[model samples]
Target: MAIRGKTILITGASSGLGRAMALSLSHGDNNLVVTARREGLLRELAAEVEAHGSRCTVAVADAVDPAACQQVIDAGLAAYGRIDVAILNAGGGTPTNMAHTDSAAVLRIMRVNFDTLVNFLCPMIDHMRDVGGTIAWTGSPAGFFGLPRSGPYSAAKAAGRVMLDSARVELAGSPVKLVALYPGFTYTPGLDPNDVPIKALIIQPERAAREMLGAIERGRSHHMFPKRIRVLIALGRLMPEWLRRRFLRVASGG
Candidate 1:
C-alpha cells in the first residue's frame, strides 16, 4: 500500500533515521504521530512536518516503558482515529568490550534495543489485527551475528528479528504486515564515525529512510540494504565458525 494519506506512528522521531522518515512521509499527506523522550526535538520535528504540509502530533514518551508506549498509541488513535502504519524505530547501541563492561551496561543495551521493540510490538499487533495495518521494525545487519565489541547489541537485535520472524508466520492469514528493515552502518548521531572500520559501508540517514519507506510501501517481509552489507552477510554465512570469528575480529579492528 502507498504511504500517502495514512495515519503513521513513528517512534524515536527526535533524531536519526526516524526524524528523516517523518519528513519524507510528511509530503505524502500523511498523518504522523511522532514520539520520543526528547520533547524539544520532537516538537521541532512536529513543526517541520507541519511545514511540509502534513498533520503531526508530538507525543513525548520513552519507548522502553510499556505504559508510555501505550500512551503514544492512544494519542495517535485519538488524533487520527486509526493508525494504518507504525514504524518501531526507537533503539540505540554503544560499542563496548563485553569483557570489561558491567552487567548493567549490557542489560541497558538489551532494554533499549529489545525491550523498546517489545513494548511497542505487543500493543500494536492487537490494535492492527482487526483493522489491518503495517508494522515495520528498524533492525540491523549486525543482528545477523555477534560482532566484536557489540555482543549485547547484536543479541538484542537478533532477539527482535527472530520474534518478528515468528510473528510474520503467525499472522500469515491476517492482514497485518510485519516488515523487518535491516540498515547497514548508517551515519547517524548515535553512530561514531571512528568506530566504523570501512567508510564505504556507511550510508546517510536520508537514504536509509527512503529504503525503509520503500520496504513498507512494497510490503516486504524482510529487507536489508546497501547491497554490500547483504553480500558480506551472505559470505559470512558460508565461512566456517572459526574462520568467521577470525575475520570478524580483524574486520572490527580486533
Candidate 2:
C-alpha cells in the first residue's frame, strides 16, 4: 500500500501522465514493469527509473491487445516473481465532433480508451485476486458527464467507471484493491493547449501523476483531482438538464 519495495506494472509508460508516474515511483525502492507500443520511450523511461534507484523492466506492447496485456503481466511476474500493484494508464482522446464522426471513428476512440483498460484490467484482476494487490485505473472527470465535443470519449470513460464500480462491489471480499483516478485537463504531449478554454485550469503531468500515485498509495477507491474541476463537476450535476446542456455547449466553444 505504501508503493515502496513492490513490483508495479504501468501501461502507457511511453509518455504523458504514465511516464511522469514512472519517474515519481522510480524512487522508494520500487520494481517497475513499464509497457507501451513505443520501444524507444520505454527504454528511456527504464534508464531513468534505474537511475533513480529502482529496478525497471521495459515491456513494449499495445494495451489494446488482450494477449499483449497478458504478456506484459507475465513479464512483470517473470522479472519480480509477483506484481503488487498495477496501473492501467493507457488511454487517449482527440477532438471529435460526434455529428460528423463515422461509426469507425467513434469505435476507434472507444477502443483507445475503453478497450485498453479492459484488456489489462481482466488479466490483472485474475492475477491480483489470489496474490492480493492494487489496480489503479486512469479515468477522467469528463466521464462523470457528457461534454459537448467529447461524446465518445466521455462514453468510454463512463463505461469504464461503471465497470470498475461493479468490479469493486463483486470483489468486496477479495484482497484486491481497485482504485479509479480522474484527472482534469493535463498538459502533456498529446494535448493541444489552444483547445482548452481556460489555460489556468490545466495542470502539469507531474502534478497529475503525483496525485494519482498518492491515491494508489493510500488505496483510495476513487480520486478526482484539482479542486476547480471537482467543483465544476459537482455544479454540473446539481444543474437542471437543460441548463447543464447550455453550460456544456458554451464551455466547449460550440
Candidate 3:
C-alpha cells in the first residue's frame, strides 16, 4: 500500500534513518507518530512534519522499556484512532573487542537491538491482529553472520531478523505484513567509523530511507541493499570459516 494517507509510527525519529523516513513520508494525508528518548529532537521533527501539512504526534520514550513502547503506540492510536504502519527503528551499537568487552556491554547491545523491537512488536501485533497493518524493522546485513568487533550486535540482529522471517511465514494470509529490512553500512548520525576503510561501503541515510520505504510500500517480506554490500555479504556467507574470519579480521582492522 502507498504510504500516503496512512497513520504511521516510527521509533528513533530523533536522528539518522528514522529522521529521514519521517521527513520523507510527512506530506498530504499522513498522520505520523514519532518516538525517541530525545524530546528536543523529536519536537523539532514534529514541527517539520506539521509544516509539511501532515499531523504529527511526538512521543518521547525509550524503546527498551515495554511500558514506554506501549505508551507511544497508545498515543498514536489515541491521536489517530489507528496505526496503519509502524517502523521499529530504534537501535544503536558500539564496536567492541569481544576478547575484552564486558558482559554489561554485550547485554546493552542485545537489549537495544532486539528487546526494543520486541517491546513494540507485541503491542503492534495485538492491536493489528484483526485490523491488519504493516510492520517493518531496521535489521542489518551484519545480522546474517557475526562481524568482528560487533558480535553482540550481530547476534541481536540475527535474532530479530530470523524471528521476523519466521513471523512472515506464520502470519501468511494474515492482514498484517511483516517486513525485515536489511540495510548495508549506511552513513547515519549514530555511525562514526574510525576506520576509513569501512567508509567506502556506507550509503547516506536518505538513500537507505528511500529504499526501506519502497520495500514497505511494495509489501516485500525481506529487502537488502545497496547491491554492492549485499553481494559482499552474500559472498561472505559462502566462504569457509577460516577464509571468512580472515576477511573479517582484515575488514575490521586487525
Query: How do all the candidates rank in terms of TM-score, highest first?
Result: 1, 2, 3
> Which segments of model 3 are wrong by more than 4 Å?
none
lDDT of 3 by residue, 1-254 (tens): 25899999999899999999999998656999999999999999999999998899999998989998999999999999999999999898898779998999999999999999999988998898899999999998879999888899899999999898788888888899999998887888788757336567888898999999999999998899999988988899899989999988887778
For candidate 2, write residues 139-201 as lDDT tens digits.
Answer: 999899888778899999999999999999999999999999999999998788987889999
Superposed by TM-score, candidate 1 places the C-alpha of residue 84 at a distance from the truth, in angstroms, of 0.4
TM-score of candidate 1 against the unseen true structure: 0.98
Give the local distance difference test score of model 1.
Answer: 0.93
lDDT of each: 0.93, 0.92, 0.90
RMSD of 3: 1.3
Ordering by lDDT: 1, 2, 3
RMSD values, in order shown: 1.0, 1.1, 1.3
lDDT of 1 by residue, 170-212 (tens): 9999989999999998989989988888888899999999999
Candidate 3: Cα lDDT at 218: 94
Worst 10 contiguous positions by lDDT, candidate 2 = 1-10
Question: How much is the lDDT of residue 243 in candidate 3?
Answer: 97
